[model samples]
Target: MSVTGAGAASSTPASGAGRRVVILRHAETVDNAARVWQGHKDTELSETGRQQVAAAAPHLAAYRPALLVSSDLQRAAATADAIASLTGLEVRLDARLREVHVGEWQGMHADEVRERYPETIAALDRGEDVPRGLTGETRAEVAHRVGECVREVERELLPGETAVIVAHGVSGRIGATELVGLDQDVSDVIFRGIDNCHWIELVESSKSFSARSRWRISGWNLGPWRL
Candidate 1:
């Protein structure tokens, strides 16, 4: 849950009596375009990614985010910067929001990884929570860290407020599973990976007894135009 930044949330929550958290995936990156394992690599966004950020920024800004946070990686941080530009809030950086670390697979193409670790890939395809890249953290490990970040974000939020977090695909999806008390086994299939620049919306119930008194998904894999 370690994050770095400064500033207070400035706006009121949307017409709701709960804490809303948006976990947004970073835009497309050079490695993503090449189908390479981006895992903890400091890859920059592609040109299409820039355009994506431009389109997606407005939707999130419309939420009138009280707190803005992002992964320290450039891809996510850069995406967060766009939203900050629209809202005039400093982006808090957190490493926990980063994508799964690929270990030996970092920067390697998907085909190369398939050739090197067929069974591992197969297990992953079947949604097994094995350690990634044979050396990196397990899915549960990522869920724990990112879920901790979500909890920390929750503590920073006031009732009836919104927080926008710029993060990566794998982490964001799995983390949302943890945030909502879902079984870790459902990470890959239940909430499938979101496209670049898409986002997951979660609401924490507290203010009103009318709403379900637990965290729940409000929307998922949503793009700017849809929301």
Candidate 2:
């Protein structure tokens, strides 16, 4: 089933009033390179990551977003900081944009999880909800939270303004799928793997909004260097 909302539309930026929301995944991190589950585990960008952001700055500068927002997580926040510095826009920290907490899987390499908790790992791979960490959030939960966050951005930001959101791959994918009215299962499969520092643009109109893949290389599975 396709999800519909005030923020769903075609690829082109809409006319009339309403703010355009651009979602960007953060640059490369050491955790990303190691193929570890880094949910809610704070990790700084590697030296190469910093350079990647530097290279991407020019492309982001083209948008001239009025406000730049990011998850409070270090990886995303640091990326927002760099973009803000380049664009002269202040960074807004939104905890709601943080990555989905992977519970017991946090900070563990994929191989380790597969070896140690084979059943749980297999369940996750199959999209079956098993008991995760005591406080960890599920994919469904994260989707709801991210949906609300997108609504809040539209409600609070001024019409005709553009806002840039720096977030994690999974969360960003969820948000994108929701915005585009795609089926959850399809979106889940398509977004299961995303690259670092990739970006998607969503343009808003008076009645609705639409999205398009802007730079997949940075956000799909490749690094910023490759872009």
Candidate 3:
């Protein structure tokens, strides 16, 4: 079944024997500020992004994350570093958590992309799951790799522990959708791009044994209120 930030029916918080996973979108990057497509383009966080990290770091650290992982890209790595600074955990770099590759569209402004590929843009807005930039990975491709990374995290985390993964906007949602086994159609329609420095939390149900129904999205687009 598909789950939405606003549509999930019920989410059983992890019990004493279950685990929690938090997939965090990295802070804003220069590309983000400029409304550019940054698929696989390594960019540093903007000054505002650094401030966002300062506001958001304490909350993620409070989770006392048992494992910290992130995309190798500088933007995600930088955000992960902040949380690691407080938690004393090593940041495990995972390429699979990187954003959907936009192919030829990397570094292009959103306006340019919209003008050049109106049909593609329209298709995406309709949740068609097509390649983003004529050569970019399709949503399914992104989900496959993202699913691999998330499942690995599931194995690494023990009951009563929380794991934090620093991820990109699109990939983060794909990972969350994979973890919760939400209906893809529902996710495509309902799960929009998450805001910078925000996060989604997934908890494994202690009562469920099936992979398809074991996890739930307990929170979505949650972030710091200060700054």
lDDT of each: 0.83, 0.70, 0.86
**Candidate 1 lDDT over residue span 1-227, tens digit each:** 21211112335665557788888899999889999998899999999899989988888887788899999999999999999999999999999998998888998999999999999999988878788899988887888899899889988988788899999988988777777788877545565677888888887766445432378877777775431
The CA lDDT at 26 in model 3 is 97
**What order do you get sorting by lDDT, best first?**
3, 1, 2
Task: Tell me each candidate's TM-score.
Answer: 0.89, 0.79, 0.91
Which segments of candidate 2 are over 4 A away from where they belong?
1-19, 129-135, 205-227
lDDT of 2 by residue, 128-207 (tens): 75545435787778888887786677567665666778889888877766665666687666655546776666644344
Clashes of 1: 0
* Residue clash pairs of candidate 2: 8-209, 9-209, 9-210, 195-219, 195-220, 195-221, 198-218, 198-219
lDDT of 3 by residue, 30-127 (tens): 99999999999999999999998988888888777889999999999999999999889999999999999998899999999999999999998777
* Number of the top lDDT candidate: 3
Clashes of each: 0, 8, 2
Judge candidate 2 at residue 132 and give its lDDT: 51
